[model samples]
Target: MGWARQKQQHHNAAFFWRYLLMASALCLVFFTPLCRAGAENHRNAYATMMYMGTPRDYEFYVAIRVLLKSLAALHVDADLVVIASVDVPARWVRALEKEDGAKVVRVENMDNPYKKQANFDKRFKLTLNKLYAWSLVDYDRVVMLDADNLFLRKTDELFQCGQFCAVFINPCIFHTGLFVLQPSMTVFKDMVHELEIGRENADGADQGFISSYFPELLGQPLFHPPANGTRLEGTYRLPLGYQMDASYYYLKLRWSIPCGPNSVITFPGAPWLKPWYWWSWPVLPLGIQWHEVRRQTLGYSSEMAVVLIQCAIYIGIIGMTRLARPSLSKLCYRRSDKSTYLVQNCLKLVAFWCILAAYIAPFFTIPHTVHPLLGWSLYLLGSFALCSIAVNAFLLPILPVLVPWFGIIGVLLVMAFPWYRDGVVRALCVFAYSFCCAPFLSAAVSKIMVALQLTFEREAFLPRLGESNPPSGFNKLY
Candidate 1:
């Protein structure tokens, strides 16, 4: 009996050693970079696609600038980096660079071969651009944000969290909008590998990909330390306060600590109904706050300057094109004909005029300026109100479709003259919206709308693009 027991003990000891060896190797693999960069600068930034010169991209750009200001407001001033696409407008890129504490890091759009091979354009809505977070190695840690998020208070303590820490958004997932991460090329490459192997999440973007990558993550409890008493290389759950949604604004007063921070308020409403939807504020919660953010980050004068420059450049481009190829005038401006549908032309004309006005009004603040507000407000609210009475009582099912259609089509139509005009400008604007902004917003809005009906979806937003200065004509604003 003693001999048999001794043999069994020896076998158990060997197994324990093997497990220890593996665990140690993992620690070395993951924690080495974290240790080396422990004293380096950390960053807080977001990713947003900017191509189409659309108002949405402008708003997000302003949001990033404001976010950096908010960080400085809390005295947690660190490097503010914006990872953007290669062809984003020079104006937008320069505007970001001009911000007091912001830097724009341009990156190429990384494609998911699996999504393309599967012909899953609609299904593959989440951006692969966010994978660049792994490559932001200059900073020891990074707090990646969705440009739409508003910081209610200081959140500097987030840096104290582990390599991968996020809030448990649902029973099965964690919020990505505001998370603490120690950027690692190793982890980033692993994500790319997963994508190459056709392992994608149902929701498409980073959240699902991240959740799937760290399956054991859901088990980690929030507001509690890990079993080992320190943050390890693996995934972790952050406190609820780190990433709260709009619902938290009222609910948090009761549960959140009286003076805690980040209490990061995520605007997870329908994409079009954002707080700063200048024309309309559907939720009636913080529409004013949204505008206030715009006001803070992009001053009235700066915004005006940007608009005037755009108008001048565009007018010049149109003039130059017509002069260069007289025949192109026919394509640039269509003759008024009875065949033109009244409704379509009216809306298109209204949009065209509105773009002109949006650029012009910043130059001269006139009483009639309020007319555009009234008109646009009527349009957006009327549309939302009319749709509110749809057959289903929950929410407009087509809200998702309309939001994206507006951005995609709106962008294309703005430069409808096609190659006859500034094709470089048009391509950049469209790509930013289609590849980056529109896709992310559509998916988020679709998810958020459903969550509102079922459960308010708490998730993160990632900015995924790169950019350099645009051409000389339109680079005056910054």
Candidate 2:
């Protein structure tokens, strides 16, 4: 009888376990879809950047596209957006949508009501369009960005920040290059209203306006995301890592931000120094990382054809000048003594102008957005070609004529040295180098003048280029 009772107890326990397993499986099957649907309904965050139609439109377009692609490569769990003015080209807009996987939001150009303010910069006129970030109420949060930002890693966790947050890269003010904010129509409308009223803006730009709008951001406690995945409320100061200025890294040549993820690097110094400009590299070593992402993504197609054409033209110029040098050397200018002085002065003027053109022409010939090595090479090649024209035309010595080119190279090498202890030291060294080079440059000019005077005295019967001048008289030459 006792054995029979034991068997019954074991059978009852097995029956209980079987029902529990069946119930658990049923709950999972029924509840999983509901949980997923709720998640789908929740508003997503976006990684947003902006573009304005300005003289540098194409440059900014390339910059924003590169930033979007870099963010996409990180697989950040947020939508990528670009707030472009309506004047942006349709082809550019399409490229952003189809090629880069970014949603382009078209906004009207915002008028800077503070334009009449003293010290106002015209470049900041349309920057007021940045206020449109608050108007994107469909997204729960948005990380507003400038195209110059370089992201080192994913920063999706920034979405968990408060209603407004920015990094105080400066001691007394926060940098707006990369900032997190909750999107709200009410806030956006109020901002527009404030602009209409001509609010007091120190810098007459979005940076000043936004800073004024959130005055207490400086005093707020530093933000740390909650472990429970809860988003914070009110304004907060972000850690130095999120918007690390590229200048900061130059001091140590390494990132040492102790708080937050050292993710984004901002180029806030000068427009020309933005990482997208090929020449910005080596000067800012981090620019290489930006270009690597660009090469992987965009691959320089927009400017390549133009770059190739310029290269071919420069090569032809160089070759033609070299081939004709002997013929060119025999050609000379001569005139009667009465007008020889006037002729000599006019010829000297023309020669100086040609030399100046040689130094200036290459800057405008090369495509503005090529790779650094390519851009610098094209520039030097073009300069050499242009200088050759002046050299053969005026019969000047080669080394003195190439002084400006050598000076440019010297400056680049000094700026790109990479071992400065701090930016102040780097700046001082550059200043000292420039001061030292001034005398050499002045001497080069003097040598050029002396060479020009010698050419003026050379006697010739047949004038191929221009009318010849006597030893102390006037004669014009072409």
Candidate 3:
């Protein structure tokens, strides 16, 4: 009986052990989370950009997409991400995911946290949300880059560096672009706290917060991990290649040491020098590479597209105006004598059409061999076009398209040609020959000009034959 009892107990114990082992194996095979394994596999740090909103925000997103495509083309293994707010259109988000195989992380829009003000208009705004980048704990390390940054060569080795690293943007100032950082919410919170209570920097936006937080560390030696598996904490200055400013690069060649093969080229500061700026091609050759990326990948010049749409809308309004008025199109720009023939009238109409075409030409294609003055005109014209399209104050749809050209060309004509320079006199001469249908349009515009002349200088418009410049009748009219 004792031998049988001992054998039964041993058999039960073996069965229990077998059952436990089977369950453990099944759990190990089935229940382990793939997320952890996937994350562990992709342990390398990532780079990201931010764009909250702009009138031309679409172009900005397209630029980001182009950067990602460039990375893929080079067969770079690093992931590129963009954290945008709800203000960014949904189409931009989809493009980032579908076309570029990039990630789009949406965060709430935050205002500029830094209290400091920039001395000049810095072309970019609402960049304080960059702080949220540090909150992405998924990435063991992160390299934050400005959306305007274009990568030239592979910078994957940057991940081997320490937690905090950046390049000098301004003299003695570290640029936030292309900075390596370890993801931690604590750092994010501390930045927020500093922004709220601490003094803001002179440059404003993200530069202030980053510069303040990492002060006196520009020249500091960074953490160099020893072969024995231990690490130290320090901030490292990035090589010039990482944050190469385009303006400063040329300036260095002129006055200072010219830098070598830059890893990234940062087009910052001037709004016009940006890759997708309206006059990017002719105004600044530096933006051409970025412009090419935009054209080849996106299928069109993104900046010119916005201008084209605005022009089309203006044309539609002009067409509708012509349809409604009927007589306006047939009328001549000059009120010429038509008793013998309408030849001069026809010539006047032809000149008006030519002027209209001239206005639209620059938006379509900038001439490669333009004079310096024409380049300046393109630059000015580009600014006026962008602002006019985005402006709410200009209710007259046609005015945006017409006014800038007329203003620039008219001012030029006034300077060189005697007729346009003395606008009021020319306007009066047209009014004097008030026999044609075009005279009414001229008369209305002339009156507005005269009113402006009187309002500001009160002597810009010369008085009529009977009245003084500041007429004695002015008091009675009031």
Candidate 4:
């Protein structure tokens, strides 16, 4: 009985082993294609890191590290190319080495001696002449990124849009903040040769040179996305979040409320580094204030106030032009003839009305309003005053020839209190206060007062003029 039981156990054990082998084979057959597919996908994914130099400052290094970390989080395998005069720090190299899939290549001896004086070199680390030369290094596609830039999202999709010699779209070409460039050693060499020979010195920067020459090289293959796509036609530009318009906020006192988080921000002239007085505080604070108020009031009163103020200013300036028309015409032209004065006044009125019509048409036609009412009103008023001054200057030759010195004064005042300048707010406030204190504040009030004064002047002066006008001959004198 013991021998029979042992033999039966051995037979069962062999059957169980055979069943396990068959199941293992079946599992491999089912999963092999999936494994292969995954491997193939891994092979297809390509990524790269490109930096011009080892950033000299801590902030820039931190930004680069942040960019790299973001790239890694997206499962992209990247190779870092550093174009620098000095070697990368040992610690940075070690840290990057420990990173699973990062490689760093140092390209030496490319520093520009004129970097400090040359804006192009200071910004791009290369002159227009040398850009093509440096671009000759080997890679499938290279992304040139400024050291200070931070990448918040995966850019792998940028690669999916087929390769071009170079691809970028901004208000201007050669943003260089972030751009994808295809590999071309020959083009790079040619660009370098051109740079060395000063072939691109006239336009001022490598960007200008590239813009001028890229069309010829690429034969319409180079892509330049427009600022507004519907107004143009091409690939939808990189989401606004991808490139923030930093200039409006940082450098200029212009504010824009982005529609969404993904809106690309582009800083012009490094606004974070240099903030503008008018735009820096007012826009951010006002935006926050409006956001809070919007929730409670369900209305944009502040914005409306700003727009109304702007409109009021515009209307006031137009009124001022009408009030000052006679004096301006007399001062602009020396001709005493009523016919000449009438023609000059008509021309001035037509010009002013045309400007007004053009300015107001946009507000009614498109709902795309940026400034609040008060702000817009102020802008229009200031614009009208300035335009009136300009038109008067142009007409001064034909009419009442005042001392040219007044035109210079006008120019200085316009410059000192320019609509776009930081000082404009104070100027506008002063003007508004003056207008409020005027004896005849409204147009009707002013016109009535002027008419009464004119009636009194005519009664007092007409009898003397009639009695005195008696000289004979063609020239009758009063």
Best by TM-score: 2
Q: Residue 205: error of model 2 in Å? A: 1.8
Q: Candidate 2's error at 204, in angstroms?
A: 2.3
- Which parts of model 4 are misplaced by more than 4 Å? 1-55, 76-86, 111-139, 165-170, 201-209, 212-242, 248-268, 271-478
Which digits, one per residue and each the tens of the lDDT, describe model 2 over residues 1-478? 9999999999999999999999999999999899976644345555555555467877888888888888888877777888888888899889989998887889888888888888998888888888999988888889999888888888887788899999999999998888999999899999999999887789999999999999999999998888888888888999998889888787777788897888888889888788878778777777777888888877898888988898899899889888886323343445445455566677778888988898788877777778887888888888888899888877889888888889888888888787777666877888998999898889988998888777654534233234343433224454
Task: For residue 52, give model 3's deviation from the true position in Å.
Answer: 3.6
**How many collisions per candidate?**
18, 14, 1, 43
The sequence of per-residue lDDT tens digits that candidate 1 reaches over residues 352-447 is 343334333432322111222332433433333323222122222444424543553465344332332333454565566566665666584555
Model 4 deviation from native, Cα RMSD in Å = 19.9
**lDDT (CA) for every model shown?**
0.54, 0.81, 0.57, 0.42
User: Least lDDT summed over 10 consecutive residues: which range in candidate 1?
Assistant: 456-465
Provide the lDDT at 375 for model 3.
42
Which has the higher TM-score value, candidate number 3 or candidate number 4? 3
Q: What's model 4's lDDT at 253? A: 41
Candidate 4 lDDT over residue span 82-142, tens digit each: 3322355656655554642344554554444334444544545443323532353555555
List the candidate 2 regions with Cα displacement exceeding 4 Å.
1-42, 47-51, 326-338, 418-446, 461-478
All models, RMSD in angstroms: 25.7, 8.0, 15.7, 19.9
Compute the lDDT for candidate 2.
0.81
Best of the two (1, 3) by lDDT: 3
On lDDT, the candidate that comes out on top is 2
After the best TM-score superposition of candidate 2, give how far the Cα of residue 265 lies from its true spot, in angstroms: 0.8
Model 4 lDDT at residue 254: 50
